[model samples]
Target: MGYHFKFEKIMSVKEREKNEALSAYNDSVKRFEEVAEKLYELLKKKEDLESYQSMKLVSGLPVLEIRHHQQFIVNLQKSIEQYQKMVQNARNHMLFQQEKLMHKNIEVKKFVKMKEKGLHEFLEEVKHVEAKQMDDISIQHFVHRGS
Candidate 1:
């Protein structure tokens, strides 16, 4: 004997949508991490360049070299700032999505529990009916045989 509930299919649909949103949020987080990593590398490179500039023994280094170092440092600062903001924003969005997912999961769980409870009740009812019918049949057979 099988017991089925009408809301099972609706729960599946809600689960699928929540999963898809989570996947997309994860992808965004990964992209933000990559950008942050690249920014860190650029900052490191800029620091190395600054260190080299300070360690120069020759006082007559070309003006172009000095200008290049300055420009590189500025660009690295801007990149770091931009990526930091991006990472923060992505993290915030991910948090919001996670909260939404949690709520959705809670809803689905409630529906699932309800469906299970309903199915259990239905099974119990079926069993009771079957048992009653068997008792009736046995009583009738006994009476007929006795007569």
Candidate 2:
């Protein structure tokens, strides 16, 4: 009975740890996804800027087109830098999440081992009790035979 109680306590602690780890991982994943989406948006904006720069004006205007193209290039460079930073941040978060998952896995393995050991001990105790009961019955039968 005491063993059972201890096993339950261990299981409860393991469960709470697992839940906390899962929540933390989920939050990390969400943040990574948001960063990825922002990066994608930035890339799309850069593509649009490139497409705009390729457009030809009706007045055969080289000067205005060149100035506009230079400004677009500068904006594109800034967007690219921002996108790169976001991607790096996301990668860092993913690595952190992976590390957390590995730790959680180790904890789960330990709890499983404890649960298995506890069950084995309980079964052995039950078996011992059953054998003792059978022995008691056999002794009673022998005494009745003599009577």
Q: What lDDT would candidate 2 get against the real structure?
A: 0.79
Cα lDDT tens digits, model 1, 45-121, are 87898888887726556788888878888888888888778778877877777787788778878887998899889
In model 2, the worst 10-residue window by lDDT is 52-61
TM-score of each: 0.79, 0.82
Report, for every candidate in turn, its global Cα lDDT versus the true structure: 0.82, 0.79
- Stretches of model 1 off by over 4 angstroms after superposition: 57-64
* Global fold similarity of model 1 (TM-score): 0.79
**Maximum-TM-score candidate:** 2
Model 2 lDDT per residue over 1-147, tens place: 434546677767877887887787888888888888887887888787666656654435588777977787788789879878977888798778778877877887888888788889888998899999999999999999999
Model 1 scores worst on lDDT over the 10 consecutive residues at: 54-63
